[model samples]
Each structure stands twice: as C-alpha cells, then as structure tokens.
Target: MRTASWGRQAGGYAAVVTVAETAGLTWEKDDRPLRGVPGAVRRDHGDLVKELRDLVKRVGVQLGTLTRALEGGFTVDTVHPYGWWRAELAGHPLARAVVRRLIWEIEVTPGQWRPVLPEAEHLPDAPDDALVRLWHPIRSDPGTVRAWRDLLTERRIQQAFREIYLLTPAEEDTRVHSNRFGHLVHHRRMFALFRARGWASGLLGPWDGSDEDEAVRTLAAGAWQVRFFHARADWAGDHELATTGQVRFARRLEGTWREVPLAEVPPLVFSEAMRDVDLFVGVTSIAADPDWTDRGPERAYWELAGFAELTESAEARREALQRILPRLEIANRCSLDGRFVVVRGDLATYKIHIGSADILMEPDNAYLCIVPSRRKSDGQVFLPFEDDRLSLILSKAFLLASDTKITDESILTRIKRGA
Candidate 1:
C-alpha cells in the first residue's frame, strides 16, 4: 500500500474502535496486534488455533465485503467531475487479493470497451478522462460474454465472486415491480444479508407508511438506484414475516430523484441491481427452506418459487451445463432444454429445473424430490465458479445418468414410485 493510504487506514481504524465497541470494524492484515506476539507465546496449540480461526473468519468476511464492492463497481467514482475513474487501491490486503485477479474493461469511448489486464503499464496507458467501470457481462453482447467466460475457464482463475458469468437478467426487462421474489422471508436474516450487500433499508411495522421497507443501492455511480421493497407481514417472538414488494428504479434528475421506467434504466445498472435482489431473495426466502413444502398455504408459494422461471444464477447454470454436458460420460443421455436439463437414465429420464434445482421424471413431469446437499462440490469435476445449486444439478445428472449402479435406497424408491 502507498504511504498515504497506509496512514489513513490505520488512523481510521483506531478512531472507529475508540468511538464504539459495538462498531463492526476489523483489523487489517498488518494492523493486527496479534502479529506482535512472540513466537514462543504463539506456540501454544489451543490459543494459536482459536486465534487463527477467528482471524480467518474475520478476514474472509472482510474479503467478501470488498468482493461485493468491486463486483458492484463501487470503486469506480463515476461522479468525478473530470469523468476519470479512480480505481486506486491500498491499505486492505483483501482489496489487493481481489483487484489483482480481476480483468477489467476500460471505456476508451462511449460504448467502446477495451479489456485491461492487471498490469501497471497497461493501466496507466488509458487517457485520464476515460470512464472505467468493472466489465459487467451484461454490458457486452452474447458472443463477447461467451468468449470471456471461456477465457476465464481456460485460465482456471478462481474469482472471489461470480464475475464474467455473474447472473445478469435480460437487458430488455421492463418489470416496474417484481413479485417474483415475494414470499415470507426471515426478518432478521433478510436485513443482515442486505446490509452485507451494501443495501440501506428501514424498519417495517404495522404503522401506516412504516409498514414497508426498501433496501436500496446506487448503481452506475450516483446516477441511478434500484430499490427492493418489502412489506411487514406478521411477527411473533423471534420469528417475523415480511413479503417482498416491488423492485423499482430511479434517476437523479435536476438535483432531485425521479422514478425511471425499467426499460429506460441502463442495462448494466439494471443487471447489477437485479442481481443484488436475487441474492437477497435466494438466501432468505422460505422457498429455499427444504421443509416449506410440508407446510400449509405456504406450500403453494414453495411450489411456485421452486418452479419459477430461470434466475440469473440459474441462467448461468444453464450456460455452464451447455458447455459441460457434451463432455460428460452420459453425453448422449443428457440434453439442455430451455429451463430444464433433461437427463435420461435407465431407471428414469429426469428433468432438473435449472432455476430451482427441482426435478421431474418422464411418463409425466412427476416431481422427483431432491434437496441441495451441504457439500457444494463432490470434487469430481472442474467448476469454473462456485454455485451450490449448479453443483447439485450436475451431481444429480451424473448419478441418474448411471442409474443402474445406484445403491441409495431412498433415491431408488423415489424412482420406482414415479412421484
């Protein structure tokens, strides 16, 4: 890190810690006082293990924070009067880890982007006034996106977060309010997830206007914003209910914010905004609850959500499957349908929904129940990115593809019962 940033990071951390004990701030790689401990003191196994585990967890959290910032292009100061992107970084080891691995795109002119490798010489070559933002996949054509995906795959560079194949909803989407994410979500967990993603929201209660909350984030610098709305449902003790509302976009116009039509929102901003909402909903929704299907009225909601149209992440899964299926052992038995990966096994020809990871077998689209496993990958295949649902989909495809060798009684009965 440069000398200037080094001082700022240290002094800032000290002040924040001095002010509030509850403030959620963490130490940097070099700033941890634990580094000053003597080698002999650190030799104690239990103490060292506990401290190392805590440090790792904190650092992981900090890295996740920076990854989201970089992915969302928050580092690009789009509001700069000179229109020069300020992508400078220092102080945080987490920042160094992420920016080093990323391949950026510099906008030399309007609608023209040149891929910028992480080299000092190439970075400085761009003119001072050129706008620089993270090269979002949605900004490019399908061919370009596909090429980049292949490039990353060939390099085997693991991204700190989903990058080239990041879930980007269709550019032409015009939904003013999305009920697609609507359902009961755990109240505390929902807000916590939103906060981690840099969304600012308010409390929702039974009162008039206070009954709804919108988690919002600025996109495309300060020019645009996306709001994910939710309404208070009911709460009892620690269990509270909230239903998702509308996803609306707005623009900063003439010193005041004005609502913008979804079609008019810039493609990159729209994609980024929708992606955040998807993450929030995907993690906190009751539909992701494995037992939600066993509930009463909520069962209908689970069914709808589980069978809902392809999410951006699921869309990524579909593309990955497209590239992976032809190379699999059961290539002939598997085919990528629009939203379902059709896998034919001797016991049953199954259809796995790319969006929800739900399964259906042949003779009828009979739902073949299988939940996502705790282990994301079985370590059998090379995955260019991390996605649990994608892993589940692939695992099921492989298992069913060689169905005659299956020994799991539960799976066998499900196949035989044909439900």
Candidate 2:
C-alpha cells in the first residue's frame, strides 16, 4: 500500500474572507479577485484592492498545497472516529466546503471500502468508530468509477481536481515509455513545466552539467520514484533542445533507492506518477505547437509524434468527448474515430489527433493549424470537467465546422492553402 497523508496543515480559507468582508470586497470561485467594483470605488479603494489581492494570492497558494496533498491521498488523521471527523472536517466552514467538493469513503469492514459522495448523504454516517478516508478513483473498481463519472456529469458538479475520469490503466504497468519526447523545447519552458509538476533535474549542457540528466519525482511518500531521462539534442549545437529517453520507476528498499521494473511498483503509485509525466509531456512537447505543422525535414518526426498512440491523458479526453459530443451544437459534424476526432467541415473533412491535438485536412491530408487560445468557441455547452487540450480540440472543431463563417485571415489562409 502507498503511504498516507492527511492535509490538515493547509491554512483553511485563512483570514482572506474575513478581510474581504471587512473591506466590502467580493470574490468569485477559485479565489478569483474581487470583481465588478464601481469605478470611483476602484480608484478610492486601491490599497484595499491590492491588500485583498495579496491575501487571495496567499490563499490560492495554500489551497494548491492541499490539492497536491489530495492527489497524493490525503486522509484525516482521525481515521476511525466519526465524531472526530465531524470536529476536524465537518465542523469548520472552510473544511466543510472542501469536504463537499470531494468523495469520501467509509470502510464498513476491514479490507472493504465503499466510496460515498459527500453531497449524496450524511457522509460517513456509520458508528462513531467507523473508518473513513478521502476516496480516489485509483482505489475503486472501474465500473464503480465510471458510475461516479456519470453521476458527476448528470449532477453537473465541477470537481476541485479530476476525481472520476482519471485514467489509471492497469495494463500499462510493464511497458513504460522510452525515447518519448522529441524536438526543440526551450529549457525555460521545460524547466518551468518540470517545476510545476513537482519534478526536478540537474542542468543540461556540454560542460559543468552533464549532457544527459534524469528528471525525477518521488511519489507515495517516498515509496516510489519516477525518472525521466533526457539528453541535449545539439541539433543546432544549442543545448536548449532536449532529446528525451526512457521513463522508469523505482522502489525505495529499506533506506536505499533502487531502480525497479515498473511491474514491481504498485498500480496507484505508478498511475499517479505517470499522470504527472504525461501532463508535463502533453503541455511542453513540440507537438503542441500548431505552427510546426510543416517542418520540411522533420515532417516525419512531427507526424509520428502527433499521431502516436493515446496516453492516459488522451484516454481521459476520449472518455469526456464520448459524453460531451452529443451536447455540442455541431454534434452532427463531429464523430470519434480511432485516435482521432473526425469533423466534417465546409472546407474539408478534418481529423484531429486526440493525443497531440494535431489536425489533418482530408483532400490531401493538408494541415489545418489552430493554436490554443483563450477565445471562446461558438457554443455555450456545460463541460463536466476542464482540460486545456480538450478545450483547444473542441474550439478547433467548432472553427472547422463553420469554416465558411471564419473571417480570420490566418485561419482562412491555412484552410484554403495546403502544406
């Protein structure tokens, strides 16, 4: 079993709310800044606004820690005492709000866990000494998990983080990735992504730092480690380009860390760690750059990377699309083919790779490059969850579906021209 952590250290809601109310300020969900203040008020209350902003920022940062804790399996320290839970989690305003956003499990008997929705009933309604902990999809059966996903959808509940629909493919245990990421990614972007995902690595260079480095992240309270290998590509003699290699897992035996075959790692720990790596690769990979649709000499590399088999992240997107497509206004125009979302557009029939979000138009497999942007797509549909790539894919589909209506020259030029 993976080690357990309970997120009690999080500065609960903190004093930000109290200060906001004192200052006559308002806030939106996710601690977004106080919005919609009048012009005169904005000018006169500048100090108050700045102070509120700083406080909100602090709260967001603290909540970020709690989010990571939950991802790593945060349980209450009071394990088996229902009254203890009431005092620690249910009694407080902030804690109660946090508890409502997540699923909790009650262990009715030893070795048997039943996931309960916090909003469904009086959560952990068993005897005072009943065992309870935060529920994770990795700890539940697939059918049950799927049912929860459906419940979230039907109820239109937005999760603090992905709970259901999180991909934990048990079959992918033995076959880890090798020579995974390709192309030139600026070290700034790469390093920032690594830091954001809680991964660390040494410098990459010819001198001082080694030409190769292994970016590693410890998971499961130091029970496991994931190492992602990469070397300087030196394609243009620039150390900025990284040629990535194998992603391996290891176990911490006694006090020494030793590399272990992925099969030896527990499934939950493996899945949790892999999700971090997948997110890093998904966001930072050159395949994400829509402008790189036509790199003459590297066309093959680009195509292979873009059209490759779906990772767990892409699998989750596929699962979401299965539910979302029917609700889309362009429902008749879109359908999911293997590894691609096929959309029939006025300009051409297009295939968008679900994994890399690369697009290929039908006439001659022409490139239809649509970069990710904050611009809203031509629809007002409720999404059960949020994924940047999913939004980008849907936005691109909407654009292609209404190709003739697209007035933007950049997009029209790409649609009319071929690579």
Candidate 3:
C-alpha cells in the first residue's frame, strides 16, 4: 500500500498540507462529526450533542402539554398553550422538523395558511360517507375528522338553501304564481297541524275550519275583504275587438260587492297580501324551478318532519332547536326561548315559531305570517321578506356577527396579549 504524506512538494517550495492528509484520510464538507475527533471537530460535535438533548427535552415537554390540552377533544387551535402555539413550534428548526411529522396546517391570515381539507370530490367511491372517510388516508385525528364532517354538512345545507331562494320567482304575476294554488289551499291545513304539535299558537293564529274551502270562508268572514278581477276586450258586432278598458277592484262591503277604482282599495292591503301570497308561492316555486332536481326543499321538508316525528314533546323540540340553532348563521341575532327564536331587528324584534316543516313569524300581534322562503344556503325554513324587503339583510347581519374568520383574528390577538 502507498503511504500518504502531509507535506508533498510538486515544485521546489515547501508544501503546506491539511491534518486529514497526514492521517491518510480525506475530509468532505458534508461529513458528519464522529466521536473522538479532535480540535474544532470535537467542539462542534459536543455543541451538537447538547443542542440535540435540549431540543429533545423541549419537544417532549411541548408534546406532553399538547396531549393534555387535546385530552378533551382536538381543536383546530388551542387557547391554553398560547395563541399561535403551532406557529411557535414551527419557529425552531428541529422543533419544526418534529412538528412536520404531526398533521397540522397553520392559519396565518386571509389568503394564506389555510389547510385544504379533503373535499367530496377527492373520493370517487364514497358517497355520503366521503366527508368522514376521505381524511383517513391522511390519518387525521378522529376529533378533527368529526369537525370536518360537520363543516361539510353545514356547507351542503347552505348550498341547498341558496338554490331554493335563487330559483324562486322574485316578482309577482309571472306564470309561476299559478303553482301557488295548491300551497295556498293547503296552508291552513298545515297551520292546524303545526298548532296541534304545540307550536306557537299566536304565530300560527287560529284555524276556525276543517278544510281548505272552509278555512278560506272563515278567513273572508271578518272585516278583511278580498277581490279578483278579469280583463276582457269588448267584441264589436262585426268581429273587431274594442281596445279601451280600465282595471278596477271588486270589494265586498256589508254583504254587497261593488267594483271600484283600484285606488279605492287600501294600497297597504294589496302590498301585505302579496307578501303573504308569496310565501305559498315560494314553496310551490321550489318544485317548479328547473334547478331543483336535487330535491333540496323536499329533502329539507322531510328532514324537518322526521325531526318533529322523532321528538315527542315541546321540550324535546326546544332542546333540539337549541342544539341545531347555534350551527346556523341566521340564529346569531336570535335568542332561543323554549320553542321560539326571538329575532332582534333594529326597529322591532320578532318571534320565529319553529314547527315541523314550517317557520312562522310574529312581527306584531296583527301579523302571524308564515315564512315561505327556504334558506337558500341551508334548507332551514325562513321568512323570505320582512316589511316588504327581502329578509336576507337580517340573515347577513347574523352572518357578519358570527363569522369565524373575523373571530379567529380576535382570538389570535387576545392570545398574543396573554389575555
């Protein structure tokens, strides 16, 4: 074997050489420090050992704290270990490497750090089961998976409601209004069933008749008057049609009906009754809309009916509503009291009476209106309009107050302040 020398002169001058060459070894920049290495290598090795030991201890303590915090349930973010706890762990190199082994995505801000949870499209084979099963491939914690499933369900419900609302006819007198005939006929009958179930009687009002025709007769029996009109062109003797005719309201007063100018009828009655009519119109509109092939409203109706059938008593329904209401963005401004969700509005608050597939609103003693519009994002039956305007503004207000994105920032700030 050829011996390696520390000093080897290629020319006449003295050669300077490294210690590794003298030892018959070649050093590489990427080489790991070995035990018994002397001088600078020894110091580097010692320092590395101490640093690793310290890092291991720190990680152990942090993991223990995390385990304890998650003993109850896994949360996306924990308040106990300080806010941005995940961020803190990622700040250290070794600790970050350790944390990468755990499945977590840090949420930094809007448009940043949002974890892309598995979507329904991710698993082709899974149907309704996809929400819970898709995360298994990633080995997500059970609690996290459960939370994600709930979120998926919530989003689906919201989408269903949005579809229902969007497909509904916004203006009156369209051909679609004809579809409301059946719903209007069945309205009183449904109200009676709602009352029998111990729903808010005040909101539902009183049903004085047994059938649809009887109910209409009873409704028209009071000072309340209703009218219908037909516009027909006069036929000339020779076959030409006359063009001039005026629209009028036929009002029944003191058992005698008379045709009067449209202005004779109170404009308020027409406006209010139109809104009331729209409720039934909206329900019928859902099925008639071409986009409702998914049976969103029908499914929502069945689900509400099922919940009512399963729940035996008023108290049970109240309890169920309490659990379900918090998940709804619209319920934020509404306080639950027994069977009622008291919705607070700027001018006046209304009591939302929850029944099987129906939601009635008592804006005041004079009005006990059924909310005709199903929530377009979720299938929760909701009032479509309030005081002539769409009820969406109220829903938006509730959403603004309960927004999770906004709450996250507030929580992060509080955590940083150690509050």
Candidate 4:
C-alpha cells in the first residue's frame, strides 16, 4: 500500500536485528516531544493521536507540515513505539536528516502488537503486565541493557557533592583554581581508584587476574589513567551522581605498583596516571585516614568483580572494549551539566572534554556519571543541561526504533508517523 522511494529503500537499513525481544503493551504519551517516547510494548493509539495533536499546536504548525519538518529533520526519541516526533521547524536539512534517521528506525522491523488504553479512568495505578511487556523487548538485548553502564562513572565523581565540571571546563583550569581542597575534593574518586589498587590485595586479596583482576591491576599499577568529568550544574540535587570524564594513560608499572595516601600522592601524579585505558572509573572515596573498615573490604572485593587486564595483545577484551565504547558513545548529547551531546558518529563532529569519572556500587547495583563538553547542533553553541528531558527523550527514542531502522529516517518515519 506504500510507495517506495530512494530514501525509503530497504537497502538503506543497517541497525542490527536484536537477538532478544521484549514483551508487553507499548504506549505513547499524549504529549508532544514527550509523546515521542516508544518501546517494544503495547500502548494506546489515542495517546499517540493526542500527542500528534498537541505537538501540532505546540509548534504552531499544521499536522502535515509538522510531520514533514520532522520527516526532514528530527531525532528518534523512542524505538519500540515507532512514534516519530520533531520540533516542526521549516526546511532545516540537518534537522530533516535527523528525522529521516528516526523514521528509518521506526520502519523496516516488526511492529508492536498491543493497543492503547482508551481513557485514564481505565488506567491501572500500578505498572501492569503491559508495562512490563513493553520493557521486555528492550530487556532482551544484553548489549542494550548494559549500554547505560558508562553513565555510572560520572556519578562517582559527583558523589563528592559539587558541580565540579562547571568549575573547570579545561584541564588547564585545575592550576588556576587550585585550592588544595578543591583539587582534592573535585578529584577525590580518581585518587580513590589509584589508592584502592595498592590495597587491592588487602581488600580484594590476591591478584588472581580474572576480568576484575586485570581491571584492578591496571589501575593499581598506574597503567591506566582516569579520564572524564562530572558536571555539577546538571545535578537537580535529586541525582547523587552525574556525568563521566575520560582520559587514556600510558602503562609503565607492569610488575608491581605500590599504594600511596592522598597526602603522599603528588598533584601532578594525575598526569602520570593517564595511560592505556579508554575510560577512568572515577573514585568516590578518598583515603583521608588510610583506614579500611569491614565495609571497605566488602566494597573493594565486589568492585573487582568485573576485573580484566588492559594489555593490547588480546582481541577478546578489545572486542569487549569495542562494544563498551559504542555504549559510552551514548553520552554524546547527555551531560551532567544538563547539556545534550548531539549524537553523531563523527568524533570530529563533536567538541568533547577529555576527562574521566569513577564508578561506584550501590547495595543493589552500580552506576556512573560523567562531565563532558556540551556539543551543539553545530559544535559551537553550548546548551545547558536538561536531565529529565534528555534522559526521557533518549529512552523513548531507543524504544521506538526497530533494530533495522535505528540509523535510517525516511523508512522509519514512513512506518511510524502516519496520515
């Protein structure tokens, strides 16, 4: 029933078909932009229709024109829902391209099976099986589930309770702003990761060289450097952690590295700490007293669970790192400062901050936060952070796209956005 064009051609499709799928009813919010959220679950069509109407009014444009604008240039906010949305601005080719990719993501794949609820009166107070089903499709893919892990590094630094990234945009700022307290406090987690390794055996006990083993060794031996930043401005005071900063380090101490206290470790040692690793798991705790508690041993022992070495010789970890890096790439538009990174493949297209964050473990799970330079649509204008909007937008966008259309637009939009 649909006519195909060059833009709509199936050959343009590229996103990997996920091996796993989620179950449940998917739904669209009855709001514009926000309504764009999608997932593998069933949702109400009326909600999407209401969303389309609201979006038309919000942007002061006709529905078709708005759709065209989005078709031309928009970003995918949801995947499973396959709902397409855009700001509805006139002929902006760049924006149009984004829309096309969004559209592509929606099309060229299996569509959701569940229908939307007709009214709020019928809505259940608790999240229902439909909601759970919606999450299942997303949950099925191990890679997709683990994609957000990189965000934890940022949280580790922000745990210090300061908007550190806003204070220093460049590494050079460290010297000018150097109050011994600010420097130490801002980088408390990095110091912890460096210090923790010396106590690795004591806390973790013996380098068995498991995955976590190599990870600990790489840090303890100073073979890796922590890079990334945590922007404090993005903190709403609601989230304890925010943003990740990364720096790669050169390896020197291969055989044995010793632990040193905060007082014993010199300031410039951070530069030396920069070595082989792609990311620095920012440290949250500092060895102010050089004392470890029963809790410390348990925490340290658990932290080493994902341990793995960083030698360039093995291809398996390299493959894992390859997978890990793409996920890390998600921070493209997200910021601890509430600035969004324009998600694009060309690293050169982005003006990024070279920094790192430490990873922290909660009783149940671990998380990260990072601080990086804000990328504008053009890499010139700096946008302020909007945590709620950004996170929800990306989450929805991921859910809307089928693996086949995650990167293509026209095809995705044609199927998702309708007459």
Which one is best on lDDT? Answer: 2
- lDDT order, best first, reads 2, 1, 3, 4
- Considering only N, C-alpha and C atoms within 3 Å, which residue pairs clash in candidate 2? none
Runs of candidate 2 with Cα error greater than 4 angstroms are 1-35, 74-82, 160-186, 236-239, 293-298, 377-379
TM-score of 4: 0.17
Per-residue lDDT of candidate 2, residues 195-278 (tens digit) = 877889876866866778889988777777889887776562432656666778777899988877666667667666666666
TM-score to true structure, per model: 0.70, 0.81, 0.20, 0.17
Model 4, global lDDT: 0.26
TM-score of 2: 0.81
Candidate 3 lDDT (Cα, whole model)?
A: 0.32
Give the alpha carbon lDDT tens digit for every residue of 184-212 in model 1. Answer: 77667888988777789986665678778
In model 4, which regions exceed 4 Å deviation? 1-211, 215-258, 274-337, 342-411, 414-419
CA-RMSD of model 4: 24.9
Between 1 and 3, whose lDDT is larger?
1
Candidate 3 TM-score to native: 0.20
Question: How many residue pairs in model 3 have overlapping backbones?
Answer: 10
Question: Mind giving the per-residue lDDT tens digits that candidate 3 earns over 1-419?
Answer: 11222432222222222211012222223233223323453344556434434544665566555433332122122222213333354333324333322323333343233233322222122222112110121234446644544553443311111101111242233312212222211233333433432222222222343111211211122333332211111221221111111112345677775544434444433332332333333333222122222334343433333223211122323443454556656665667754445665433444443322222234332222222332364445333112111233233334333433334554334323321
Lowest lDDT block of 10, candidate 4: 157-166
lDDT score at residue 365, model 3, on the 0-100 scale: 26
